[model samples]
Each structure stands twice: as C-alpha cells, then as structure tokens.
Target chain A: MAFQIVINLIIACMWMFLNESYTFASFVAGYLWGILLLFLLNRFIPDTFYLRRVGKVIKLIFLFIRELVLSNIEIVKLVYKRQPQFEPGIFMLPLDLKSNWEITLLANLITLTPGTLSVAIAHDNSHIFIHAMHIDDIDESIRSIKDTFEKAIMEVTR
Target chain B: MIETGIDITLNISVSLFILIGTFFVLSSSLGIARFPDIYTRLHAATKASTLGISSMLIGTFLFLYAEHDIVSGKLLLAIVFILLTAPVSGHMISRAAHKSGVKPVTANRSDAYEDALQKHRKNS
Candidate 1:
C-alpha cells in the first residue's frame, strides 16, 4: 500500500512538471491521471489497488465510532438504572486473526466498544478472554464480536 | 472578535461538545465507583474515558481551527494517541488482574479460559 501511494504521488509530481502547472488543481488532476494509470497497470502489480484498502480503513473507523457511541449510551443507561440487575462474566472468544497486530487491534476494538473488555489471551493466541458487563447470552456476545469488529478487522487487514 | 453568526455557531458547538464529553467522563467515574469487580470497572474506565477525551479534543480542534484559523496538529495527535493507548493500557491492566487470579464477581455461566487452562494442565 505504501509503495503504491508513493508511486502515485511521484507520478502526480511528474505530471505537474510535464504540464508546467504548479497549482493545487493541477496536482489533483495529475493525481487522478495517476490513479487511472495505476488502475490500468494493476494487472502487473502484486497487491490490490491502494484505494480499496483506504476505503476499507475508513469504513472500519466509521464502524468503530458508531459502535462506541451506541455502547456508551447503553453503559449510561445501565449506570443510571435504579437497582441495576445484570450478570457480568468472563468468557473466551475464539480467534480467527493470525498476526500479532491484527489480534492486538481486535482486542483494542473490543475493549473500546460496548460491555466487553479483553481480559487475557491464550499463550498460543487461539482465544481471547473477554469480561462482559452484561451477559444475557454467551453465544450472542460471541456472534456480535465476530460479526462486527472481527469481520471489519479481517476486511481491513486481510 | 465580533460576535458574528459563524462565531456564535462555533462557540455553541464547541461548548456543546465539551459539555457532552464532560458528562460521559462523569458517568464513567460513576461506573467505576458503582461497579462490583475489577473487570467491570475496566470496561467503564476504558470505553467511556476514551470517548470522552476524544470528543473534548475534537471540540478543541474545531474551536482553534475556526476561531484562530490555526490547525492544531497537537490536539489531533493527542486525540489519536489517547484512542490508541487507552485500550492497550486497559488491556494490560485487565491481563494483570486475571494473571493475579482476580476473578469476576458473578460469573455463573462459564469461564472458558479457566477450562482451557485446566485442559492444558491435564495434557501436560
């Protein structure tokens, strides 16, 4: 991804020099041209186009923000309830992520969203122990994590 | 600075964001005191505090950008750093707690981690 971005920027600068136009608009035009050129040349490249990854990253950020706000509201409601009745438990979530950074990001995202806090991970990195504030159903919590944050993370990384 | 319409809008929104941030922070503190166990407390401490600080920093970024026409990189950097580090720190704390055998207060359903540890021990 970084290589593609650098190549694109270099192409844009080359375009500007060739056109003898130094304005921001010309730079943008050159960038567009570079994008088209790169798209056409993508068959020779090893990885997918960089913009697809960028879009996925943006989507992950938005998804995280939405989850954060929704979870915060749920927490607020739980906090203010008179005589709150909820069951908190520690359960293991099986991992599908392979790399260190991806697992770390998954843990961080899980901690920052909703009622779940990542307590520990197995030595082999096969599972993460999560402490959820409200555990009405274990499978439901696991499914939610797998479907939302885990799925989004897989999209971003792999 | 004259109280122009844009200025008024900016001021109001900035203050509003700050106010919302403060509320979340306060509620998080409440959660910390009111929760039963270390693990539950971590949930409150990590999530709410992160959201609170990010919102406040975003407000500050907006205010500076609009009022002074100065793009504050430091504010934006601070927000990103907080978001990144807060969860890691929270994870570390909880991991330590678990390693130290700080059990959840009301875990009735199942503790798969403990089960896994037992299985590993038996296999070894």
Candidate 2:
C-alpha cells in the first residue's frame, strides 16, 4: 500500500511536469502540487496498487498507439471521400474497472482516438457513455468499446 | 554554400510551420462554431487545438533556435510536454462535457449508455 502511494505520487508529479518546463525549483513545486492533488482526488479513487498492474498499463499504451494510427487513417478516408461516411451515434459502455483513476484513463484513451468521444461516466462508475462518430451498429459499438478498450483497461487495473 | 542553403531551408520550414499552426487554430474554432452539438465540437476543439498548439510550439522553438541559438534539449522538453499533456487534458474535458447530460445525436436508436448510467443509479 505504501509502495502504491509512492508510485501514485510519482505519477502525479510526472503529469505536473509534463506541462511545466523543468527547472529544479519548478519540479519541487510540481511535486508538492502533485502530492496535494493526489491527496485531494484520492477520496474518489481506489487507494490500492500493485506492480503487476503497471505491466498491463504499459501494454494498454501500446494498444492505444496501434488504435491511434489505424483510426487516423480511417478518419482521413472519411474526410476525403465526397460524402462523409460518419455513422454517428452514442455508445453506452458498461464499466468493469471501478477505480476513479482507471476510469479517467479509459476516458482519455477513448478521446485520444479519433471519431470517438468520452461523453460521461455514470455516478457509480459502472457505465461510461461514449459518442462514436463512425459506427453503424450500436451493439458493435458497445462491443468494441467494451472488448477493445475497456477490456484492456480491466485486465491492467485488476 | 551548403550551410547557407540549409539555413535558408530551415527558415522556410519554420515559417511554413507557423502557417500550418494558424490553419489548425482556424479550423478548430470553425469546428466549434459549425458543429451541432457539444460532443462534435469537443472533437473539433481538441484535434485542431492540439495540432495547432503543437505546430505553433515547434515553430516558435525553431525560430528561437535559429535566430537565438537556443539549445535543442530545452526546446525538445517543451514539445514533449505539450504532446503528452494536451490529449490528457482534452480527454478530461470531454468526459466532463459528456457527463453533463449532453445527449448523443442518435437519429434513430435508443442510446444504451445513458440508459446504463441511469441503471447504475437504479441498481445501487
């Protein structure tokens, strides 16, 4: 548990530094801010972590990159064609992972990919409603959102 | 002669990048205006702004380097940070917009997720 706390604090600092340029002094300020943000947000998120989970997190990132390239190609085709082929709709995704951080990460993945938007998470964290701009079948949309994205997230954060 | 030509090429590239950045910012704002709903607008805002900001940052960095002798390492830090942080912040914003009851443009079928969110409340 203590290990996870330290890891979480480190990640928070990493995100903070990702925006602000590095000076030793700025980093110290970021570290303190990260700690404060983490502590404040901790109430909503699960406060546990494991080493194995980190490996899955790495895998999920690779998956996201693969999806990103393919989706960009798909969007280009959609735009270039004379008629826009967007089969726009919303996907109501059921959540398997309950951690606030994990759910937020999942939302980030969806938004990072083109043609999809993370519209909302249910109050209970069991559902994440997403809007898809290029899907035809709602069931398939849900399946992809579930199997393609959420499943990866579930395995990693589990 | 080669060194001079290289410098000239770099100058052209930096100017081109700035022009492209301006285009991105224009299209994204256009998207925000033209798109019908919150979700579509979010896409326009995010995709366009990221591209714009990234290009603009790179352009500024190159300009600084070429004219001011700025080191590559420091400029690189700026580029990397923008690339990483923009998407994450964009994601967080879109999620907030979605949760605020902005319905999807479902011309025909019933949305399952909104229904599901309701169910999440019902079950618990």
- Highest DockQ scorer: 1
**Alpha carbon deviation, residue A37, candidate 1 (Å):** 2.7
Q: Which candidate has the top score in TM-score?
A: 1
Runs with alpha carbons beyond 4 Å of true place in candidate 2: A1-87, A94-102, A137-158, B72-102, B121-124
Residues A1-158, candidate 1, lDDT per residue (tens digit)? Answer: 88888989999999899999899998999899999999999999778899998899999999878988888888888878889776887788889999999999998888877788887889999989888776767688799889988898999887
Span of ten consecutive residues with least summed lDDT in model 1 chain B: B104-113
TM-score of chain B of each: 0.90, 0.83
TM-score of chain A of each: 0.86, 0.60
Kindly provide the TM-score of model 2 when superposed on the true structure, using C-alpha atoms. Answer: 0.61
lDDT of each: 0.86, 0.68
Clashing pairs in 2: A92-B113, A119-B98
lDDT of 2 by residue, B1-124 (tens): 9979978988999999999888777767766776666766677665556656668878888888888788667656876576567666766676666567666666565566667667768887
The stretch of ten residues in a row with the least summed lDDT in candidate 1 chain A is A132-141
Q: What local lDDT does model 1 show for residue A49?
A: 94
Assess the local accuracy of residue A76 in candidate 1 as a C-alpha lDDT between 0 and 100.
85
